[model samples]
Target chain A: MTSQPEQGGGQAESLTRLTEQLSRLPGIGPRSAQRLAYHVIRAPKEETRELAEALLGVIETVRFCSICQNVTQTDPCPRCALPVEDQSIICVVEEPLDVVAIERSGAFKGRYHVLHGLLSPMDGVTPENLRIRELIERLRDDTVKEVIIATNPSMEGEVTAMYVQGLIAPLGVRVTRLARGLPSGSDLEFADAVTVARALEGRQEF
Target chain B: MSAIRVTKLSLTHFRNYAAQDFQPADGVTVLAGDNGQGKTNLLESLFILATGHSHRADTDREVIGWSAAREPIPYSRIAADVTAGDGRERVLELVMQLAPRGQAGEPTAVAERTIGPSGLRGGTLQKGYKVNGVRQRSASSVGDLAVVLAGPEEVDLFAGPPADRRRAIDSTALQTDAEYARELRRYERLVTQRNAALRDARERGSTQRTEDMRLWEQELIRAGALLLGHRITMIDVLQKEMLAAHTEFTGRTGHLALEYRSTVDIAGNGGASPDLQQSLADALEGAWGRDSATATTSVGPHRDDLRVVSGDVDLGVYGSRGQQRTAALALVIAQSAYIGQQLGDEPVILLDDPLSELDADRRERVLRHCLTPGRQVLITTADVELIPAEVRSHAAMYTVKNGRIEAA
Candidate 1:
């Protein structure tokens, strides 16, 4: 016997397609996507039309930074281009949220680069999977004084930080891990603002 | 092969279901509705059909419709039809009927679940169960059918408090191993008994009577150690799967990890098996005197947590809500894959708005990696615009409004 499609195409086919697509995104699932889709369907025409336009607009306009690979509306995100910040230190992070966390601490006046992800052999994520090459290129500049490895303290976080630090160590640029006590195996985003600030202030040479 | 498909799940006088039924398509059924729209209710019916208990913690009477009139007495029932996975041409119908309102004074209500493999009239009725159908002799004797749900509340599988995460681990492990489940229940009961005995001895001021305490401790150690051992093994398996799945789900090269945080750390000085087991026993024994004085448990796997971290950062603590959700999602998806690998039958996968907190890239990665052939995946969502393009191409859709379901 053929397994029935729980929700078939004929009934809300476009809606299902949208939900399936939405569910495929980072955090939206079938249920949320369905509710959202129906929300759009049942919503006032202008609201849904605006959402549809925004969805398309974001996809069309949003692109990763050429240098940091952070999602951006511009080629090099603000941090990559801003001249007011110290260009000597380049803070490396796994995701864009880490950038926000570091920025919230107000400790570091340096520029930032987002790697998109870390290296996990078991999960098939490797150096090639992230923006390592872009980082390497950013480091090739002679004026850069330090590279802060702000990756979380998990095994994979350490591995990524170490791998990147090792690659650029020969260049004479300082590579540092965030100071300990932020809790091992925890993400940076949820760290209390003060803890993150302290981790930033206490960075030591790797 | 036929899959058990719940086309219209309407619950009247059912727990939290004020007359609700939502229709879903075959293969990948996505139930997209707001919270409290009887979403879990729909899945509850399926769970009761498979495992014979509502995942909800409420009683049968609580599930009855309070709105029903007084004359006829309110009742509850769940109905579903399945096409056999064995490729049987006939539609299989199953109904679980609850006891009438007047008969439910006892703590446990009797119910009957009838299986009609062919037609509504010809199905066999297994009695002694009330309208709700939980077996009389053993609540679990209801059968070996299973359903697994992945929801946002499970974010703790990676970052919540230890007990929250432990329950998830124990729940899945128990579902698979009956002996493991029994041992867990026994261990919990014995821990209480041992603690009470220690308290009693202490109140009587009998330190010399510690031998009786030792006897209870012995039982505690034996049962507690067994529980810890199963947990250790489960964590080991979960770690390997989590690592592989994290990589696959993120489509990046990041290591995924799972480690059991026991009450006593593994002794670094001794060999693997003997020392670890002894340390666990010691911890459990020590907790009896020390923790009982304080009226709490301080040692054993019950205090342990399975930490899901990526790199050096815990996905639960440092990662964004989105990241934690992804980690949790990966854990469940990987568990399903592992279950499929270990047990040839791919268990039905239930995802309740799994992608609600994720961004676009991570969402697509989950679908591409997690949902595959021979697996029945049920997904629910609230936004149609957030879906990625590829996923939209493959799934069938439906709409649910005010508990009524129809093909969209």
Candidate 2:
């Protein structure tokens, strides 16, 4: 089933290994990986050395922030360290990308806690695999009032938020999910029936 | 239901047929053939073309011709030209081939024994759809062509396992209700995810109410409620039609009730959408302890049953073989009426050897039931003498021999 271009040993073996490693990345196929390898070989020496250094530099310098679990060079991410009007609010997100998405929206003014991953039971991903323990520990005090669960509306994301909500319920902190509805600039006429149904469900008062 | 009439059907490398084009008559078409001469295969292809699924085959790959490997691309196609009640003409196509788009390797099979004989390397058999030559997702093609097949296989519907019964209702809902496919898919996925959560809780030996288990349960409740609501509505429609159909076909006046025995306890067993969701939520919570212990969902639509009862005699459990066969026939006729009532266009009725078990009187009545004008019908029989003279006179007869069909 697997008909690859690797035939000989030594040079061919190393090149095949490189192609396999590169193809392991998301959206990069074996052909694209081989093309990348060829491009790297034709490039200048320092350029190749700089690419290797950049890859290593990220792994060595970057680490998950101890507070919110967002990737950062500092112990506590800048977002976690900054002061806000209300110290009693926390916006929980699934990953660092979610944090960036919410920050770009500028609609939220609370602190953020990145779970780093959603709760996927099928994949054997439990609460222990995520940053739920850290989140519960952060809620130990009565300082935080409301926790806005900014997880995506996917099934896994919904379960993860609900799990966090269940834990936070006893803590007396309020839990809320992001509203789901139609997209901006899209006509209601062209929207699919499910989208229209959800938009009607999440409709706000005029 | 929009009345659908299949004008022309073309099969290329399909099971038993290397290539065959057939034009069925408007009212009735009877396919006559001896056993194993591809009589049922014709009806099966029509079913696949109509519903995008084969009711008999365990896998869609089985429908691909064994000689399909001789073709350059190794693909099987079933295409049909249909006209609706308003005389709107359309073409629908379903193709089964190996490999995903663009990327190509060995044949696409993890372990297909049938494809193995072809000596093609491992490749996956993927099904693709086209509406009027325009690529369309299978989900978007709902209600394009509605079909009700009363085959011997579905006769076991009453005595069949829970999965088969659920699939029967789902199949009907899938073709008639346009929104049903998406909701059903969503509901199944949620059930899987919920089962995973329960299993995770059991594996971890969680002491404080398995983390995120309720969240998934809550999500499943919303989705499951929608599914239950649809099934209840579907059962109501089928119950009404089957009651009349059973009496008319069998000449028995006993009330035939199609009861949807749901796993979750909605307020009235099946209330309005909001009430149904709340009831499902309550039921899930009640079953959580057992569910977490067993690491499986205890209550959901997946565990429901469709009970076919004729005046206290549950056909699945207490009926005789003859009685079960009668009920199955009634159910198929009811499904046809239900699709017609729901879609406004009557579905194309394909009866594949349904008369073998029925006595002479009911056989003629059953054929007369489907002989309604403007409704296209296809009947496959091992012997043409079994068909009533009236039906035989009205039908455009065709003899099928070794996958070959000829007008008789």
Candidate 3:
């Protein structure tokens, strides 16, 4: 019984191929992959074709912006290509997804620089692996007066932000970080003591 | 009074038990069996379920059944149907799977295997915990089942090294207070990361090592202060209860005291005042030179000890074997009382061959204290005669044999 192949292996070649590829995705498990394969099989041909085209299209067309290193079809991403309203400020982030998040808030109309990754020495992700050189090169022009480090509030994220701050500060650019504290709509009772303490310490007057 | 009780316990591939289910009685449940008949294993299953780690076994793989050794992915699970203090029933389950050593693509496995090297022929142990079928941190699941285990090795707690005493206090505090558990985890992680940073500095002789060390020290001080604060507060509470318990059990005129001994000077305006965090931070800063030279943290709660004393004579150092055992029992009993008072729920007491070392009178005293009304207790023994006739008569008795538990 241990030596026998799976019962449906012979008849499920296409399904198996699709499931294997789906399972390789970030959040899709083997069971979810199988479910997704079945979904694709039952869906209309046009829907599956569109899905396949969108996946391939991303890989075929998307390239990192020459200036900010954010994924974009144009050499300079739209954020960098836009007339810089706040040319003196550049908000640095850890990933292109973070750029989307910050942009969604519309709180900052300044330029953006994507690091692509954070500095995690334990995971062999260093400043060399990230686009730190590119960020420093942008800072060398000295047009940006305030570089806002908007990395995630995590150990690796903080370390990367600090490393970038150290590099950019030598170029006379004032470096700042996003405030760390409690999230909005979260009760103080539910928040952990550390977050509460930080929130209290970083409190501001209305 | 409300109490957490185990309504049902089931084990699969755990220790000597291939598969066993037990419905322990509310007041007192006695497990009678000969040695090596899975008697202690039954108590151990309850302990692991409550604490998320084994009290007897050195490694989780040691708890996996021998028959499972040949399987590709050997695993063991212990599940309990626990009724919390509010009468809400939740199933707390702990599953430990043995994976092939050096397996990649699993980061959780990396942290779980920090218990030195695995002895199970290249099988690494990975544990998963669930409360009411929802995946959760093992430490968080401890809130579901609180247990105070008084076993043979507990006697060593008073007489043995500081680590044993620390474990006793930390485990009990962890079950009762969730914040303490989280701080302990954060403190441990910070220590590991700081040590790695120290090692990296030593290897490279980096000039920025001091700056890096300072940053790590600040974070460590923050986490360490919380841990030290919790441990000291817990020790104060345990001290009072332990004194009460010692007097009740031994009926001795001598006074019993518990002191929280720390490497850092937590005296005067230190631990007792608002300057506790400042004191800890100052101590870390002062020790930076020495710590940098040694490449290890020199002062913190990790280096602290719980000193048990009777009229100025330390029980850990000067007490006789029996006296030490009694002190250990008193401490365990105090922990149970402490948990009961703090959580408004009495923790289930597990006595694993606790009477074997005590004299008849002392054993009776221990049993009387444990068998008090409104408390759930489980006692495992090789000889049924060791249990008092009064307890034997009122208690539900089960005989464990060959990995099976049957009502006697």
Candidate 4:
């Protein structure tokens, strides 16, 4: 029953290799990786081919936008290439995902500049590691009147925003943060004290 | 006054308790048990539900039962069903699980391990909080089930370090005022980050360190001023109540006073006045040289202390044991009253063998004060007689043995 080890070893090795590769992705554990590998093994040949092609296509074509550091297929992301209707305001974000989130809101018509990461000294993420140089260079044109820091509300994010604010303040551009709102449908009683206090502070006359 | 009570409490894998359920009475609920029979554990579970932290144990792992620790996926949970002053019922739950450590720089062996269906592979711990079955931050869960715990540790309020006194006052303030809690949390984060930045600046000796330190100082002053303002106001209210409580309990003719000794001179500008922020900023700026040398943010509310005095003598330094205990008790009682006055709700009081350190007369006074009408009181004692007869007659008593509780 245990004979034919040489015959079975090739396929087992491939499955093991796929599982190991999948496990290297963030949030994918070994068990999840194994399950995904087995699913892929059972998936249609065309589907697997398509998945592999998509992964390779992304690696080959996608690049950071030269203007805003956002991951994009074009040199200047679509947002940067837009007409100069709101050339006076540029919203700064920590990552391309943040740009997507803001775009989903549809409330902001201004352009965006993605920093790609926050300033985390403990993590050795210094200001030099981020896209701050490009941000300051964009401000040197004197056309941007407002720089909105839309970084996530975290310690490192706040530090990065403040650091960028301090850098651009001398350039005569007003800096603002995205208003923190009470999450919709959340009970005022259940919201954290900070969020509740901020919501009250920023309340509008309904 | 609105009455806040814990209607039901359930514990699983918590200290000394494999599984236990308790339905506390509206009035006095007595937990009578021998030593190590989970009496304190029962009280601690309720306290944890209210405060999102344990009074005795520093880490959640310490609160997990030994037998539970032997399980494949070791975890401890404390849940309570509480009725707010408005009669709205809510469930607060805290689950602490042992997991592999995920902090950076840790050895790869101690890093995130595959949490299989079987069990966790590492021994580090993490805690999760839930309110009404919905996940929430620990701080946000506070005040949902307001509680005032007076264990034997209360006696150390006056005698213990200033940090303890600050914590006692901060805990009460956080429960009463949401604004104060927000400011306090922000101030704590500012202090930690500022300290880290200070250490980094000192190590690098960069020219930008001065400007960076100045920016942090400005933020610190803003946050620290708010914290100082809240603490000062709270101490003022607590001082009056504490004095009254001490007078009622001791009947001795000495003035009890509570003073907030802030690192910054709040009195000069009348306590967090418009000018106080500037004053604090200036003070922090002046301290930058020393802070840089020390590699720590040294001047802020973090270094402040609460001073308890009687007849101009500092209680922490000069008071006798009995005097210290009475002062501590007075502070606890005053805190309950303060909460009632501020929040319009009387917090549920949990007393764990507090009568042990007091004389019979003092014990009777404490029992009367705690068993105030409409306020829920849960007391744990080994001897039933330790509780005054008047309160005992009205109390719903239970006996705890071998980590089990039943009606007595």
Candidate 5:
């Protein structure tokens, strides 16, 4: 009887581990896990099997765009994978929000790469703490025209923009700072959509 | 010989004062008063005259009096006579009018601007430094005049986080050396960008982008190490001085130590070194997995904590109440000593009834050792008995009651 109980315990432990892993994803909590677990339990047996197959499909298929580092189900996320719309221009921004900000402006039909954060040394963030390598990589291509640095006009933002500008100056591509009229020390996410669009329109070279 | 002295000072319609004047003696002048009796306000005005900035960060409106009865608006003015290093006497005045806000946002001034030897409009607040009735672009010309204040807020040095201590240390360091502050500002900006980038990597679910992460890590290590080095050096000096002060005040034989506990494991790095850089790089790579798991920075000096300890016990924990007060006092005295050593003049010590927390034995020891010669000290207290007889005899005394200051 004890040997049989041990056999059942191994299966229960594996199930618990999976539940914990699922709950760890953003916006998923323990209660959500219970709901999801029940969904798996009560679904049509074939459909439940299909859901596991789909999960495995994504795990096997998704990869980062080699150029922009954006996640995609295919190589070179759709935006970066597309050809020669305008190879000369690149917009550098802090996050995907900034990418959205510039895209929504309907100006600068160029490409974009996101640097996640600004330099905040007190909080132990430095230039190496950001995605500046890929940015420098973008600079290596001579046809890449103006790199509009769309970092927020914060101290950290300005420092990052300056650091990146300094690193790529030898590459001879035009490095530019986003115009200052945008309010200082504010996150790009909070800026009114119109302000974000205009800032992009009026970017100036560093 | 001291370069500057405030010989006679007066205020009319100034914060909490209807009218007041004082003829400061040579060296130490202790201003005694209770809380809400306008002692700090009085000192603040003197500081404003010396440096254009108000130590109090509140807006100008709070500096003025507020009345609800549709009464006449109040006026805030400070007049001081200063003797320069060259033996020249100059009279400077600052005046601002206050008006009660109406239902609308408009405000009216009760008085116009005035400053002198001769009246001039807003001349006192020129861009950099004021001259003999002229404006100059350099505070360097204002000579080596400086003040160090140790009020209740400095308690944040120990009780508050590293950022608080960093700011406090940096502010004092800035006053003596402007270049250090500039480097700090540049370094701080870099950290923000680096952290934001790390956050984006997590949100985007791309840990394979090691090149991008590596770029930020390099810059972060460079800037972070510089700041860490400066802070560590400052803390080392501060620790030695503070421990001595703590012993004198508390008469305790226990050992006191200051530790800069960095979150990043750069123990032997000493800030800028190839090995340290590599260690940080390796740490960043390791932390990448965790950063993606939780879209927040998990490692680095930003999460650093500076600890003050007596033997094995953390001061914040097992230390007695008396030990805590003495530690607080020691920290301020240490800061003051650092400023004094750096600038060649002891900071003017302002004690706002700090003795209220101390027993008689400890209070006496504090007065004897902490109040060194050749330093300007101002202590405010309602209980006159707590003040040592030696201090009372040599000190310039003032009494404050009902917002009125009178010579004692």
Candidate 6:
């Protein structure tokens, strides 16, 4: 006979709900989600409380910066607050994490604009979903010179970058894209043919 | 020894084969059985293992045994233990499981092969490739067991549509250069993406082109140039290879030629030269007008053809049946030699009833040629006596009946 086990114990219902919610997260499958739920149930009460607090902490404090549209706790993200040598150059990216990637390189001391997503018609993603209007509004100033499209070299990423370029090009700002080639420290012999071809095409002056 | 000979092949829920394990000979093996006895099914499982798709099955699920529904889970598995070029042995496996329709997944050449137009009826077909227990894309494992298949149907290469000829060369390219497979998949996706972009623009009633169009065009050309360049270089090499084999096959070789005719001007450029890329770029740019009107790409390697010309006669148009058949056989032989020369691994030659139409003398010639020292040849036939005694003397013979295979 099929009986509701959760009827006798509310904890079973809570465990089921927790597994479902965890499974919805990226990279967490049903089995992993169930394992994670069980792990949470087994861990000490204080550790589980810390994880819950951390989750709430991010949602409560995280906000998009009004200027660059990157997730931040402040109205203007730290990157936007900083003064750079070039007000004209702004690197456009698909996500806030990309901003972190660029900052880690310690190069390109300029402004940044996060699009939040790429243009993917197949997945129903479109230009309207991204923060393109904010990017264009930032480019309205005559001081802005170049908008380098730093989206990933993927199909949807290219479409988003090109769409943004179309909007900014009319504002008289120069448009550019990140160079794609083989990664640094990779041996040429071991490099794939496609990567080698890209490196050859993007060869820089020695 | 053949570069990579399959020492053992195990199949389950595949075609008429409910469960079967085959051990091919090191030199030449013959499978003799009546029609509908699952002779070709064994070879087909090996073909799918080598190339990731059935040579004849329009859909991948067609390979699943009809009685497969009786099983708890309807699936087909083909696994092989191959002796690689260096005499090192490894396991390669492919599994096709039934999955619910409407599962959107990564676009792979193998997946594309499985799903046809009517395939959307939701027949569950999720195919995968595994190498040495670690899963990988079929493209990565294709050349692991390089095989050159010569069958009766293949004799129609010249008479068949240009698509068939293009596919023959593409198959060879896909096996020889793994990058070609990646580029091929990218090019296919680019074409679809480009067409979708064009359709979106048309729906929006836009007359002015956008930077996205230029971007797609640029990427398309870059990928297309590589495909065209590789095909041209390969066709040139195959022309000479096929010629030598043709000469040896029929003692007639002067007029046999594999001319790669392309929309791009490849007259001067050899291989994937800068000149060749420039030629493709110019061609695509020029065809953009026609493409915009058609909402599809009109020029590229997709439209190119590999023409087999016998002197002044175009074999596809006007070749005798015998000439076409011999040439097709030569093409397969040349392909095997080419794969061996390029990858330093002699490909296992699969001849599916190839000697059915040939005379005694020619069959002897083909048998002598295919069963040469160190080469692995697997040929199937209904008439066992057609095989010369000297040939059968050393061959590992097998008999198939009602989907069951047994050593002869």
Highest TM-score, which number?
Answer: 4
Better-scoring candidate (TM-score), 4 or 6: 4
TM-score of model 4, chain A? 0.85
CAPRI verdict on model 1?
A: incorrect
State the TM-score for model 6: 0.73
lDDT (Cα, 0-100) at B296 in candidate 6: 80
Q: What tens-digit string does per-residue lDDT give for candidate 1 at B87-163? A: 32222123333322223321111111121231111112222222133222222311133456677666445666666
Compared with the true structure, model 5 gives a TM-score of 0.54
Best candidate per DockQ, number? 2
Question: What is candidate 4's lDDT per residue for B274-362, written digit by digit as tens?
Answer: 56687578677778778778877677788889888888899889999888988888888888888888878889988989888789998
Q: iRMS values in order, in angstroms?
A: 22.1, 7.0, 9.3, 9.1, 24.5, 10.3
Off by over 4 Å in 6: A1-133, A139-155, A158-206, B66-74, B101-125, B268-274
Clashing pairs in 3: none
Task: Count the clashes in each prediction.
Answer: 98, 13, 0, 0, 32, 2
Each model's chain A TM-score: 0.80, 0.91, 0.86, 0.85, 0.64, 0.88
Model 6: per-residue Cα lDDT over B1-408, one tens digit each: 446788999999888888888888888899999999998888888878877776763656778775555443457899999987788888989988765333334221222222333322223577887878766644345558888787766877878877777777777777778778787877887888777776777677764566666667777788888998788777777888889878887755477987888877877555544576677778877876777767787778888887788989988789888778888888888888777877888888899998878777777777778877887889899998988888899899999999988888
Q: Tens-digit lDDT track for model 6 on A1-206? A: 11212321555777888988986775444545667898998999999999999999999999999999999998888778888877878999999899989989989888999988887544445566789989888877788888899999876787677788878877898999999887888676655555677788989997
Q: What is model 5's native contact fraction?
A: 0.04
* Chain B TM-score for all candidates, comma-separated: 0.76, 0.90, 0.91, 0.89, 0.68, 0.90
RMSD of each: 27.8, 5.9, 7.6, 6.2, 17.5, 7.8
Better of 1 and 2 by DockQ: 2
True contacts kept of 3: 0.00
lDDT of model 3, residue B223: 79
Q: Model 2 scores what on Cα lDDT?
A: 0.79
True contacts kept of each: 0.00, 0.32, 0.00, 0.04, 0.04, 0.08
Candidate 2 ranges with C-alpha deviation above 4 Å: A1-117, A131-153, A161-192, A199-206, B10-21, B34-42, B45-52, B61-78, B93-140, B266-275, B399-408
